[model samples]
Target: MIHQPPVHFLGKTLTGQPVQKQVRKLKDLDNIFLDQAAFSAADMNRVVYEVFSYLPVDEGTEGGLFFGMTHLYPGTVGQEFYMTKGHFHTIENRAEYYWCVEGEGMLLMMDKHRNTWAEQMQPGSLHYIDGYTAHRVANTGGGILSFGACWPSDAGHDYATIVKNGFSRRLLSVEGKPALV
Candidate 1:
């Protein structure tokens, strides 16, 4: 249950992460690529994305809240847009909330049956991803597409499924705008 905190705490900027700073490269997105050849040919040394995770301070509880920010660099491979290596949760029933803080992007989601959904996101936009769906966010606009997300600490990422079977729809840049192809 949600309860009020007993003591005061200091707040910090989202970029201030004392826990983890993860960098994702083109090679890291191997399984989620629509154009495998393009991905393989793209510079493996290039840093494609970044993630900053902030864990709860001394949360001695199961399924506690965890927050993080993902930064997808703006670019493309062939026609497919640059996207995060999306994933489903190990605990399939767990959900997450994402709030866009910078740039523009799209949250692409799919279910086990290949049904797809896409949401246009800009600064201040908020979205929820159901635990039953596999989701990926792409940088469809210029600059860094950054978003903050919170989920259950126990809701581990299951990227294997997404890597094995990519999303049914692809977000492409059509006429300088995002188009689901």
Candidate 2:
């Protein structure tokens, strides 16, 4: 995938197309067995950043691949250290789903209006975010918030950067999401 910024701010590619980039070797992800995933607050931030490089969605994320999601390495995220800040993903349109593959955490659901609700999650847990729903992934335990996301479309391409910071996210539409109801 190429990120050709508009000629004005991104500078001129003369051809208007971004420089050509190719996919070479795929990065090898860390080998973590379930027994190793015991999240502690001190390691939360670093692990999240490190695992981002290996997310299934690590395309342009690593090399510009789009339409991807990460099966969070257990213990890579989720710390009771602080609250899971909020964020949103807007594509041409938006629809999102989170499937818990491993570990557990708390999901804090906040609407555009900022009303909130919280739910505990675990492996096999299916958390669906049908757009319009403002949400946060909180680490309510000593484990990582390892999970997977299913976008109805390629909306997550934009979300890759945003979710990592764990803050500075916007809930584009508040209309459909039930306000933590």
Candidate 3:
């Protein structure tokens, strides 16, 4: 797949016309809280950002290649960076790949056993999230943090696990920079 920009931001390209797409809003993330003091259940209805998935060739297919973009707005809850609700693939054996197309952030990954890894992300940085690993993205930049990702269509997100237990570690904003907390 090519660049998956927001539908409203697209125009006709020389290759082909941009397909109309749906926007997935992820505003309710109180369940996946690491810093309880920072996240408030009353603010769960607040909109954080949105995701736009593009699968131009997948008419009715599953377990095939699908790519999309995640635009994370800049903000913070206390010292914690704004982040995505991390999850594992429900299919258990389907890996996913993420590439930072714009802005700067950090990818936090962990396994069922709590083995953790943190990677800094910026324009052109790439990361491979192995199967069974729960992953989340944190925006550390001053503006929007945009990243593109691809994975098998059948690798559904299992967010309940992460919501229930949370990640082994958390990403915090330390002096306006990302730090492991």
Candidate 4:
């Protein structure tokens, strides 16, 4: 098979070619957020985040890498910050890397045993996520929180598992600062 060409990206934007974009609105995370009352009263149509992916090879291709950027808008539901729907890799052993390009946030991770941890994400912060862990990002800043991610093309996402079993810990705003609870 022929080799796929390199993909280029600038800051939080993908360049040189068109990418597949997925926008997640507040309504898309009906049961993901912790506060039911805040979720119900908020504007469901408001955009929460967007993912831009540049896939050079077909998904699930071993040895191939997929690159993407997640742009999480600043907002809150009750005291909880805006976040992505966390997921584990379908392969279970596929690790991934995330780099904070801009904004401040938290990288929340939970292992298979339900143990949870979080890392502060700032500009230039890099995080290594191990396999078998469910991971999610929360935007705690007042501006857009953007980050880049790289993982094996074969590392399929398992969102359903997280939907059924939510994260053990949550990142919430406390007196204008982020706190893990």
- State each model's CA lDDT, in order: 0.81, 0.39, 0.76, 0.93
Give the clashing residue pairs of candidate 2, or none.
59-63, 59-64, 59-65, 60-63, 60-64, 60-65, 77-145
Indicate which candidate wins on TM-score. 4
Instruction: Give TM per candidate.
Output: 0.86, 0.45, 0.80, 0.95
In candidate 3, stretches whose alpha carbon ends up further than 4 angstroms from where it belongs are 1-27, 35-37, 41-46, 56-62
Name the lDDT value of residue 149 in candidate 2. Answer: 50
State which candidate has the highest lDDT.
Answer: 4
lDDT of 1 by residue, 28-75 (tens): 777676777888889987888888777765433465988788888999
Off by over 4 Å in 2: 1-45, 49-85, 91-93, 154-181
Q: Return the candidate ranking by TM-score, descending.
A: 4, 1, 3, 2
Q: lDDT per residue, candidate 3, 47-129, as tens digits?
A: 55666666655533575777677878887777787788889988887899998888889999998799878999998999999
- Assess the local accuracy of residue 88 in candidate 1 as a C-alpha lDDT between 0 and 100: 90
Task: State the lDDT of candidate 4 residue by residue for 143-174, as single tens digits.
Answer: 99999999999999999988888999888899
Off by over 4 Å in 1: 1-17, 57-61
- Model 3 accuracy (lDDT, Cα): 0.76
Q: Give the TM-score of candidate 4.
A: 0.95
Which scores better on lDDT, 3 or 4? 4
Ranking according to lDDT, highest score first: 4, 1, 3, 2
